[model samples]
Target: MKFFRLIICLSIICGVGSSTYAQKNFAKEADHAFFNESYFSAIEAYKKADVKAKPAEKARINYQIGECYRLMVDPAQAETFYAKAIKLKYASTNPDVLFRMADVLKQQGNYKEAQDYYEQFLSKKPGVAEAEAGLESCKKAQVWKAEPTKHIVQNEIQLNTESYDYAPAWGDKKHETLIFSSSRPGSTGDGIDDRTGESYMDLWITTRDNKGKWGEPQILPETINTEDNEGGAYMNRKGDALYFTRCPREKKTNIGCDIFYSEPQGRSWKEATKIVLKPEGADSLSCGHPTLDRKEDYMIFASDLPGGQGGKDLWITEWDKSEKKWGTPKNLGPKINTSGDEMFPHLTDEGVLYFSSNGHVGMGGLDIFRAEETGEMQWGNVENLRYPINSSEHDYGIIFEKNSDDKRGFFTSSRPEGKGRDDLYSFNLPEIKFILEVYVKNKETQEPLAGVEITLVGSDGSQVVKTTDEEGKFIYDENGSDRYIKKETSYNIEVSKDEFLGAKSKFSTVGEENSKKYIEELFMQPASKDVVIDFPEVQYAYDKHELLVDDRINSEDSLDYLYQTLVDNPTIVIELQAHTDCRGSDKYNKALSQRRAQSCVDYLISKGIPADRMVPAGYGETTPRAPGLECETIENMATNEEKEVAHQKNRRTQFRVLSFDYKPSGSGGE
Candidate 1:
């Protein structure tokens, strides 16, 4: 009986082995067809293997079929196969299969379900950073609002899509004509893009008629557009000048873009000239998407210089109308930049900056963000535009429509329903709301003084309590809570620090005013000090050394303080030193420093300081308070910068009291 049972088992095993061999042959053919790009044939071969294959083998066959369908762009069919394979539980224990399922769910925009699979995959593979990033993105997507279905447009005004229209920019002045870049068939340069096989992009203009309709769009003449790619345009308020980016491709090398500007002539634009704000050796560095302030004196653009934090960063340069050139560009720094690409900067009349970035947590690829200019060359922290506007796709090139009532704007995206590549979409931004922050510091040392308390007592006797951070910074929300109606309330801010005089300041904003943004910074003083002296404000001549006659040698404010200092210390000997910024000849600067020092001494004598007790000296451009400092003198700098800041640092007067000994009237003194 045992021998008979063994013979029967052997016969059954042989039958099972024969079936597996046949199934393996079918899977091999399917994989070969898939590798050859014959996806349809691979699917048919896979179906044949599925019938004879066991549970695990069948699941593997289905996964391969799903991959082929995904590569063929049939995501729905691929999703179906992945779901079937998952149900079979062959790869339910493997993280790779779970990740594939999550990716398909994400492509379908079912973020909630995708998130579940992503979490499971991450649970199995504990240290996958990309999986974590995707999980966060899905979480954001789950809560994000859907894009608005209705367009916000004025009555009878329609967006013109007659030709290939995109990349719109507004002049500095309000209600001026709209300038855009297009690749219409009638453009002058009949050549096509080597990569896309489409017409090259060039700048175009469309004027606004009295009826508020855009007139026919026309390509800028040959002198301005050129045969190369010319886009990313900006115009001055007067419309007399224009700045744009031009990328002229050289045969095989990947030449980067540069900024150029053209002045308007009687009817047409003159020949465009290259603006060299970057150093000569760094021509390979890219600088584009420039936006000038209303005055056209300041410009902000983007560059990918080596020293930047990472990727492309924003930079600014000032226009020197006298030199007919641009000053050196300075990076906007870490506050506005991250380790991701930031581009498309747009400056508003209200000093609000609109730019796009991929660094910040966003709905997707690139999100439009806003920042306010806090100081002369500094910007506040950036805030994302947030839901409905940004999506998990490449969204960029945002610009506001001029003279529109609804605050409607246009931006580009490569989202699902677009006409191949990127398409322009219109959106209306919500009302402007912000949080105002104030920072206080010691003027002398520029160090943050903490433990300072401030009370915000409104005019209505309603108190909103707050305190400063360890860094002497305080934040106030402009839009208060729902129950607290925001109104124009005068705030009596009482500030106090240890061992220092207490001070009070007041501020109130007009109610329902949405046009302007406001910020105030205050510097406080210590209660007492041993000696106090005021320095005279210095002035300089333009490219010359002769001081103006009417100019007072000593300011009354300085003289008053000097007299008080002498009265407080009757027998004090003082020394005054003068310095000059790094400009002009070294010997000439030394002589000028000496003359300036003597001038101070003469002024002190006129104020009744004993001449015998005073010493005057000059240091010229040496002994700088801030060493190796960039941005000082306009001339003799390493870079081609017109050193405005260097000059300011150089023109200063410093004083030191040498001795303070007085003789007693009735007693002998040695």
Candidate 2:
């Protein structure tokens, strides 16, 4: 009774009625229409044959009716016929019937009943992956409904008709023009498609008004819109090339759809030519829903060709630029695809791939999911976009705005309360703005320093370079000329000027609530010789000369700063100055200080700094950090706590720049 089994069980069951001639005639007509993809005509014929059908013929007739409704995407009607077929025990060996029934129930939002049918199907056929996914989706559907996303979806009424109008694509970089496929009135051909019982689809173009309202929908020129069913339009990032689907009607069933492309001719498009992504003479196979990567070097599409995972697996092919030809098609593999259909792939500029899949565990029907490309031609961590972005209807063909950071886009959906069989809906995440304003200043004079180059590097691999304006400030926000910084991403800000020392700092928008403006001041010191900085205490155990464990550059640890400073100022040479308290013997303290200073130098050398760039000196118990402390004797200190504090200050390490020029052994210049 299931769709796949119906192909194998094509032979009709004979009727044991007195009027066998009429019963057989009606059943024969229905089978002919069904085989030719004329589900509308087949549904009518099957109903007429139902009355005269025998007990055995009844189940097959009901199952055929269910198939017609399912293909039409009418789950409510399909559920009724499938239930009847199940009650009659039609094709009891085919567990696909139970699974199909469960699928329809899920689409209708009856999760409990759908779960029951999924369990029944799984009981007979254990380890069925699709059935297991269906059960999991039912549970997730309930949870998703309870906590839906903040996306407020609106049906674009002006551009829609009382027919299938979907698969919207932005025709311009600014998204001022829109192009989509529609099977509404005034198509190229007056003929109706047997698949959907509607007029053949055609590409339509529309424009958005200055007030953000859609204008009248107009059919594209005859160059692109032909007598055949042409739709599923996708354009390259530059908007110079457009790829679409063309399903030419055949004598029997339609010659399977193939992907075709057209070049822009001024403001309009020229006649389309087939891309020939697959091997020659594979006319029976269907390919559609083309998506080109940001670089336009590779394209992914949905195809029902042979040697796929199953029905309509997503396949990719590289575009040979110099040769100007498409390479062989390759499947996306099992992680992103399944036995069920996967289509409508959209690869974002950020390398995040979004596609629609029925095989993946989702609410029901085709749900939109996104996956980050982990490596070359590899994708994982698939996540369903969740409702109300995806619904229990066929939601697909999403298109995002060019250079958009706020996640604004339009998608096609057939959910109820729409103006047509399928309508376009606009969605955008609520923009939470965070502004960063950084001011560069002189460390010694506290005067603002203008024209300082500030470079921001993000954890997401985003880098922006800017110079401080006359106000000695660089500002970044959602409305800035530069790329917007996203939330939950840490960024490192590096500031430098001609005569000033380079400075580095970091900030993050993680866990920030409400829109806030952050003001930060970065002070740069003069890059001169013998520049000393008071450093952190190198906490060594009692009488110990070795460095502590966990030697990393962090808030608590400052030893790595010695290495980083050398890296930042690559040509600069420095000396490690180590000191100790007055508690120990002078000679012993000197030995300990020397070892500590050598430890600092060794750490720097291990980090790839040349040994000649650093010099170690021990000023043990000789130069006290607290100049006011009378260190002639330990008893001369004010109190025990005061003496301990002074000693703690004295038992520290500092570095002073020796020279700004230090050449490597083979690099020549000094």
Candidate 3:
């Protein structure tokens, strides 16, 4: 299996010498331990044997120590020992030693030194894939270090622990529920994976509330998790079915992993059933990391089966929806699958495919790469996502929020500063613009209204007026070349036709952290005496006649709309109407309503609207939302909540155009 291949490599390296001793030769004993994959024991024994060995044997022992440290993920130690071995001229003539030295340097973030060693190795052994890859990685790493993308990567501290937690996927409809794999404590499995040296991996879930706070993580049901390792989970679009990887323990070693899926049954999952990829029954190889396109017609997974280009190749299989089976597996070809492992495939809804690859040149281990499909089964334009998304550590398995449009996502990484061995990270491109797509329609007929004038007044004092097309649509980035909206800015939008009452709204991107395209459907009402436009409900402190400054902020939607309308219709005169709830006496409420209406008029006057073009009117409790309910009756009979609702409905402010015949002082008479 691919998981065991690394141990196998260490075991096969550094040949042991035959020697006679009443106490067995320490060098032979160390080599024996290395062959059996007891790396820690092998390192201790090798140190003891080095002091007793000859000069050449001592150098070989040092090289073995470097390999052990490299496997243990101690790049600093690996680089130190590899340098000592090189300085002592132990296996100095071999290209493998040069390659190992370069690999360790790259992992240690010494790109310049790694590049020289890789070039030397390639010169000695031309056409070596790994050497070529290492060279390319160094060059790209330098370039990325100089010019990096503006992506903010954050560690999800609340969701992580001092253990491996990674491979995040959206688990529910709202994209707020998160499902990931963790090898932390409280996992169902009691056994540990030798490859990870932690508890067996299991699927866990957490949820984000409406306030964007994440809840505590919980283990998946027993039906899906067993006394073996199970992880790399992904849910279908519906969130009803789950597909994951399962590697059961056989004796002391892990049987090769296979992909399995479970369907939800009430609150728990049904027993998992293996999705047989090949008819050959596992093939003593591993298969995991499953991903599907938006339509779920085709599936891609990582496998170490024969007839592949290299280590673990990405293979695709089509789902037979009618036959309820999968088609024959096909490799992604040389374009994607490299001599090194290419795993953790993620296909975004936008049709781009992203996967982690060691076969391709990267900063260090398994940098993420994206490929766009050029033809059927043909992926091209493979570009590395670059640092700091890719670092001198293993980073892979990215999953985006369902409809975040490539702006934000969750990915797994083993980079330093992580809470555990492998932790989940949230990443997003910080530079984003607001996208507004407006649809104009007639409020009465519910039909599209064309040729409507759409005006947008930005908080930055910039303004743009656009006409809706024949389809009553106006897309801000129609040609995908220009953008009209900006981040951290708010805009007051007004939609109007020649003979229609204007519609208004306030769209804000002020606190939005993600880039999203907002589709707003605005309706315009026909201009008539019966037409009345109401903005969002505004509240005033009890028994306060003065309009607070905070209330002005709340009324910006109404104020801006009225301001824009006045500008659009310079000759129009309007009346501001205010009403009061059935809470106070009619005499007092009527006086309060009149004061509220006067305050609205005062606000418009301060904004430079001509005072002669406006009028204020007050309707007391007699004109409540519930016309028959009186203040005293309601106060004596209704519940507190019901009274408040009734009060909210009646205590409102609205406006209506009184006349369109008012002309400016110097304008021609109408």
Q: Using lDDT, give the best candidate's number.
A: 2
- lDDT (Cα, tens digit) per residue for candidate 3, span 1-670: 1123221121112123223222447777777656544455567778889887887788888888888767656667778888888888864565577788898888767899999888878888989878987998888898997888778899999998888787787888679899888878888977444333556667899998888889999999999989776777778888877988876645434256778999999999999998888548644567787888777788898888778998888899999988998887898899998888888888877678899888887898778899998897668788999988888777888887766678788897777788876789999886676789999999878899999989989898889899999999898863256568877888998887766767777789899877789888988766565667676554566776455447345654456667777776776788888888866688998999889888888878888999988898888676765554556656775588877776678888877777767877888865
Estimate, for each residue in 229-321, the C-alpha lDDT of model 2 and write its tens digit: 777778776879888877665553336677888998987778889888656786667778788887888988888767888877789899888
Count steric clashes of candidate 2.
0
Better of 2 and 3 by TM-score: 2
Model 1, span 619-639: residue lDDT tens: 777756465543243455655
Clashing pairs in 1: 632-646, 633-643, 633-646, 634-642, 634-643
Best by TM-score: 2
Off by over 4 Å in 2: 1-24, 91-93, 433-670
How far residue 423's Cα lies from its native spot in candidate 3, in Å, is 1.7
Error of 2 at 293 (Å): 1.9
Off by over 4 Å in 1: 1-134, 146-164, 320-324, 401-406, 417-421, 429-670
TM-score of every candidate: 0.47, 0.63, 0.62
Which residue pairs come into collision in candidate 2?
A: none
When 1 and 3 are scored with lDDT, the better candidate is: 3
